[model samples]
Target chain A: MQSKSNNSLIKVRQLTKRFDKLIAVNDISFEVFKGELFGFLGPNGAGKTTTINMLTGLARPDSGSIEISGLDCSKNPKLAQHLIGIVPDESNLYPELTGYDNLCFCASLYGMRKHEREERARDLLEKFGLSDAANRKFAGYSKGMKRKLTIAAGIIHRPEILFLDEPTTGIDVASARQIRQLIANLHDSGTTIFLTTHYIEEAERLCQRIGFIVQGKIVRIDTVISLLQPIQKKHTMVISVLHPDEGLHHKLISEFPEYSIELVSKGQFRIVSEKVINIGPLVRCIEETGGEVSEARRIRPSLEEVFVNITGIELNAMKKEKQKNGRSS
Target chain B: MKRWIAFWNILLKDMRAYYLKPPNISWGLIFPVAWTGMFFIKSGKGLDSIISLLPGVVAISILFGTTSMLAVTVTFEKKNKSFDRLLLAPIPLRLLMLAKTSGAILFGSINAFIPIIIASFLADISHVNWFALVLAAIMIAIASTFLGLFIAVSVSEVFEAQTFSNFFRFPMIFLCGLFFPITSLPIFLRPLSYVLPLTYGVDILRGAIDKGNIMPLWLDFLIILGFCVLLFAISLKNIHKRWIM
Candidate 1:
């Protein structure tokens, strides 16, 4: 039998890390295939950044191993780093340096010759749409401009694997759209991307495989279709009603014990169940409670719903925590 | 060849960011020259007194200028998060530190050079052994640069790094026999002077320029070289252990 890691470009086994007494990453194991865009979705303080740090050689794992392109990362991270590019969440490029200079400087750190570094720097500036601002100091760039410059800097060396942490957590809609398109373009060119994001829709759109991490451990990993498939039985029904009474939710729950009913508003209700719920019966129950059903339809399961199901925590709760942590830390 | 290229890239970037600025370039020259002028006025046209002060003045310039520049570089990067890029690079950490040290040496040596030239024309320290002076100046530059690296890696913030730089540098000026001869120091204080790198540095500089022998010239040279190696190793170890992650 062949080993499971045979075709994987990155293989991690029982990886763990600690800061003082706190265990930041705990025995996590996963594999990322070559040229695959894998999304590591998690809330704040869920060990996502810590795991990335260990994998990128910014920090060492206290236990286990990581292999990248058949290179043992734990033993020879310098060699491993040569094959990877990392875009940390913050724009950490030199503020005093011009956009062109930052890209050139990053290329030079990878030991690129002067002529090639400048050439590539100019190319990246044009590609990222920063050519007009190429000579302006990075300190003067807007947040979106800084983000583009940072991503350009990371890829200056043209590594095979790229790691991006929260590439678009907070930015204007247009700029965010631009960044997503750029990421997709990079992936199309055969670069394996490992991205972490709080935006479930972003992950569902970009990732070929998605991993849900919670409390420092990966709860589940699967393709987008596979993740949604297992939760198909958990269906939701949004019904438009007339004169919806407050007691209608209690009546529906009492009559249909297996179903969960919630009044979204006076004239709207959301009904959920683990099995295919019969809206025919729900309509009768609504009428008995003196409400007229206007519209009823099943709502498809979103990645957010799947994430909420897998992590056993509300998605909004995680977003609030992410914002708080972003502020304090 | 690749490592050298990487090193030069880092060196070039740092020079453009910190050492290449006009204010900084002038600061290195003005500081030592100003101190030398003060000593010249106090000595009242006695060429020997001013000349003796020249060696100590030049040595102190290299010490303060190099150490402060490096400390500022490291702490500023830490504050602004650019240090993360350096730590994440594929090159060995030692090479990065070496590149930073080399830049500091170049800046510091130029700082020492200005005073030597000014003193050569403005004040006469007769019978100067040009060879000994050149060698000693080079050694002082190397040693002071490494000392800068040592202080830089010990702190995490800009204000703290500068505070610590002064905390250590202020004492060295008086205790390293820069302003006073080592023999003039109390017997108990002589041991303290011997422990400081600047003591041997000043000994070499003063020995060469004054044409007076405190110890053998080669002994001073050996000691200065040893300090360079020791301080360089410590700085490299500190940066690797703390900053790499």
Candidate 2:
């Protein structure tokens, strides 16, 4: 994968943000290039939202600088904000307005002409499958419909850089899939997308480069392939044998010294290796040992494992900890 | 030109959202008309006394209605985080503030005229100086709206804005001689009334209605202009700080 600095659309240098005494985002720096789908991966309270807030000019950073499309956000907030669109964590759609009116309002803020705003809003509403609900008030929209409307509102002006915070949270699976497809299409059309999601599968599928933020600091930033490589190296292979003998397990471990063999009840055995390579060797060894191999399959590690390995705690555990802290506080 | 367009957009949207609604229209018209009717019934004098008090009552209504409405709406917007969307927009902060103040002023001006228009048919308003009274009422509306915007931006919470407004609202309404003549009050309180914005509004309102010259024409105009400048300056300063920081 190419480095984001080469085609950098957004750049942050030594960014630090503090709310009173508590430091929300510690010293951190990263770049997002144009047309790259960048994933901001973190557990709850990991400063993803704070980073987005600063980048979008919603909140002032305590120290450091942020540049959007080469415009300094701190110095030229209006100009910088004009180049970016944001879908915040919470759906901030004006409930009193209809879906179409919400987009029109955003277009008005961008100083678009009335006819142009109407045309663009119509196009976007159709694109997002919200045409039927265009005239319906947002207060009556379902969660998924509201999410789609908010997404449409954010991108109404066609900004070059887009910030989405948990764009699929609290939505049904079908809506999540639709949103993911929309994001993919946007990225394919050359829009730089900076998104934060708790769904590891979504991140793995959608992100070109992923940053793992922990404790208000980025612990790791790498491509999805690179981030998953360490855990992916450990492949688990299950085999069903014709003979249920202790001698077969010993023979397999001896013949393949690199593989760890575990005997199961009846005629099943599990083999673990650093990688899914030389499965033929195990099959050959089983044939030589007078055992019949019925099935062979390799299972690679998932993104969940990669995340746990990097953070030293599962997402659920972190959430539980946060819940405990909340109760105590 | 862009600023003007933005200001009109905000004014029109606010008018549609809050003013055209039945409940708001009823509140704006009914409240002042009820107050005027009760005063007329209680003090059933000739048309002169009732018309003399009309300007002061309109000024009082504009101050109370405009300030409370703007302050409360801004507070609600802040609480709902909707203000963040406006702050992030490309429009200048000054223009946005101007838009909100203009909306409140337009609503307040309408509210001030609602009762007076109804009372005109029943009473003798031919002697009332309509031009001077309308001009003074418009100035009072602008001043009150700007002050409301200033208070809205300065306070962190809506409740605090409400409490702080009472410090100015009640005193301006009562001591500024909205319901009765300031000359009826004791001598000490009379000087303080001259400093209130409503005092000038009432002076102009009554001067035009009753054809009375309580103060010189230039002095009343100067006082209203001074209040407008002061409130506008405070609102501008507050908005600049909010946007830049």
Candidate 3:
């Protein structure tokens, strides 16, 4: 792809990483614009973490280049890391140290002055709703508090770019909401955010451009609106039936060659069509097939459907059950 | 200058988290003093005899206590995965190693001094050479702690690091002329005694207290200093290979 704009804060090309015999990230290329919340959407083993590790200085890339703010970070990580902040999936912090001290120590790693770090740490503690627990040891805090403190530590130095891996993977709903709010506030304050997650709704709600990575390859990269635009004309109407025949899915598929019909459960079926789907054929086909439709309504196409359509796999199978929050977490 | 500030911060954090703990301090002090005290009782005590035991006991304190402390601290971080935070920082890996080694050395010196201060008034100091004694103590601390650091970074688990440290440390105590004169060792073991870094360190301390030159202070200092450099270099190389690359 050619340069779409000159204001790209991060440009990656031909990036690849291999662990023994498996290539974790393979020849993937993308650019994150300034102040853009770019989401790398993929399943568990899709190499999202591997790509982030290479972008930061934690691991070396086997081939290709990563230019962050015009510097070759893969080759010169020390200089690049100075301008990037990392919040790894795990909240890796000193458990023995208090929350306040942990923040101070992280700041000190970047060579911040004592007074400056103290002020920043206090402000972050208050902002993250951790002031009451600031004096508590990190190990003693709940999972939510630990996650909040880890994020606070990441932004202590105010780096130009922030890399968050699975930011809200496992946490309570309230904490996840607060973390998302913090992330939004950071984006609003003009800090570029690059995050990876398996949550389709998270990518849809937060990211301006979402990249779908499957098995170490990027399948597509575009705005959420554009990705969903192709499915706009397709109707995914859900119908309620008093009787559902087991053979109805195949019979409908054979009759309407251009539409996908699926039995969502025993009493419900969904029909996806390329054009306006008339209920006359479906109702008549169900009646002839020993099924009765009690009601029907058009359901909006969710990002989950878009993802499943693009990847040919259900979104629930890719993520853990506990990682699923209703809408945004 | 900023690099140095970061170095100091690393040292300060490790010192607070690991070195300042009561269990860690006591572990470095208890055994060395107990063994020496037992020996003093068996030898039918005299001020001179008690003073002679000080150098060997202090050397043992550094060998066992400092090495174990450094190993345990590092392995704890590795096992718990907290060390990842340090790895992501922008500072060079070598500087972090320097800060950790320096903190371990400082704690080792303090641990060694506990017995010496108590023995100071009990022993006859008019015949002692304080300058050479202090120099030998500092050298022993550096060599032992850096060697400890090498073990810490080379192994994947805490038990493995401790086992590797003791695999080398236990032999040195027996062969390093700490318990007896080097001439008294069997001919085969005599060469082994000279090869151990603790041998020169113990000899220097003994020579200082006795107001006698064992092998010329300069030669012994150079040997211990050489051991320090070799151990520190190996540690840095291992840490980079294990964590950085």
Candidate 4:
């Protein structure tokens, strides 16, 4: 969606981070152009946080080079720190400080003047819908409020580039939606954003270009449109049957040789094909095979399926992480 | 100029978040007074001995106050990952560390005066060298705060940092001639006393308050300054090797 401006703001070459015997980020190279919302998508332990830490100057890399806005930050990581903002996975702002104070403190770290920082902090608190809670201690705020304030603190200085690591991993749905909207507004305002998330749908909804990282390696990097192009040509449908016999799936597969069939459960199965399958024939075939079809619906292909196909990671694993994070929230 | 701004902000933030709290301020004031009273009664030293007890009390106050505050604050921030936010700042690492430890230094320097204030009420401190006392208190605070920083970065947990700090602190109290002369110690243990930063600090305080000088005032100040620089350098190196990596 025209995410690139042909002006690269971040460049990395053969970046690698090793912890003892484990290589967290291995030889990954990609450029994020100015004003682009680039997503780094991966499952848990896929080195998403590690990569963001290296880019944000939180952790030193074992090997490789990084350039932010044409400043070589390999040896001197703090050289480009003034131009970028970072929101870590967890809310790292001081719990003892009020929301307003946290923002002002972060602005001060970037060397903003006292009056300017105070005004900016107030503006951000209002914009983030946290004006009422601005005076409250951060530790007293809700999980969602804390996340919002952390994001506000990250942008307190109006940095040119922002790094958000799992911004909405363990937040309420409403907060997640609001955060996504805020990120979209930031991208629209021409701020280059490097967002790392495990939510495939979140990436598809917000990012222009997506980088799929698996086992510390970048498996694919392409625009959202380009990444979904191949999957879009295929039609998928999930059909639910009432008390289907064991042979029902075999019979359906034999009858529909052109479509790929997989038994999702005892009463559910999915059918995928290159061409759109006629619903009438599939229903008739199921009925003829002594299996009463309860529900059959065409499903749209999503980034989730593309991610699974590309990374060879089961969707169940990602879903488990989502559930775990949800329970914690 | 930008670096200085960041440095001041970091120091001010730490003050607001930790040092300026009413509870900590009270504790800082009360602890030194308690130590003074306890030691005075324990030694059965009358009013005449208050001046002699002043140097040890001041040194111990700075030592304990800086280490306790810094050990807890730094390790707690590291545990909660808040220190990572400071690490991402645009300031140099050395400057950032200085900003972080300066709060504890200021707290300790103020703490050193608590015993002096208490003694001034009971004994005549008019003869005391005020300049030397102030210099000794500040250098001791700096050296002790850096030692605390070193302990904090060397460990991952708050409790571990405290335990690590005590390994350096408890020995200094006895071996550094806090209440007694280093010559009274066995010859083998005398070398260990000089190795402790507080030994030089207490020696300076002794020269200032009691006119008891074992070494020249310049040598005492020089050695204490060297310890400050050395401790600060080592702490910064530990932060790079253990923390940033």
Which stretches of model 2 miss by more than 4 angstroms?
A1-6, A236-299, A318-329, B1-5, B154-167, B183-195, B211-245
TM-scores for every candidate against the unseen true structure = 0.92, 0.83, 0.92, 0.97
lDDT per residue for candidate 2 within B159-215, as digits (tens), equals 988987888888887787777678899898988898887788777777877756578
What lDDT would candidate 2 get against the real structure?
A: 0.79
Interface DockQ of each model: 0.72, 0.33, 0.69, 0.81
List the candidates ranked by DockQ, beginning with the highest: 4, 1, 3, 2
What total of clashing residue pairs does each candidate reach? 0, 0, 0, 0
Docking class of 2: acceptable
lDDT of 4 by residue, B1-245 (tens): 87788889888888888888999889888877887887789778688889988899899999988997898999999999989888998988988998999899998999898999899899999999999999999999999999998888888888898899899999998999988789999999999998888999999999999889799999999998998899889888888888887
For model 1, how does the per-residue alpha-carbon lDDT over B18-51 read when each residue is reduced to its tens digit? Answer: 9989989889878998888787778786666767
Q: What are the lDDT figures for the candidates, one per model?
A: 0.85, 0.79, 0.84, 0.90
Q: Candidate 4, overall lDDT?
A: 0.90
Worst 10 residues of 1 chain B by lDDT: B236-245
Tens digit per residue, CA lDDT, model 2, A1-329? 46546579988888898877778889889988888899998887889998998887767788888888878885556767778888887788777789998888877777777898899999999999999999999889988888888888889889898899989877777888898999999899888899997667789999999988887898888888888777766878788888645587778878878878877546677677775657787788788778788887776566766888888875567556545533221
Which residue pairs clash within candidate 1? none
State in Å the error of residue A219, model 2.
Answer: 2.2
All candidates: TM-score of chain A: 0.88, 0.80, 0.89, 0.96
How many pairs of residues in model 3 come into backbone collision?
Answer: 0
Better of 2 and 4 by TM-score: 4
Scored by TM-score, the top model is: 4
List fnat per candidate, in order: 0.79, 0.38, 0.65, 0.83
Any runs in candidate 4 off by more than 4 Å, and if so which? A1-6, A327-329
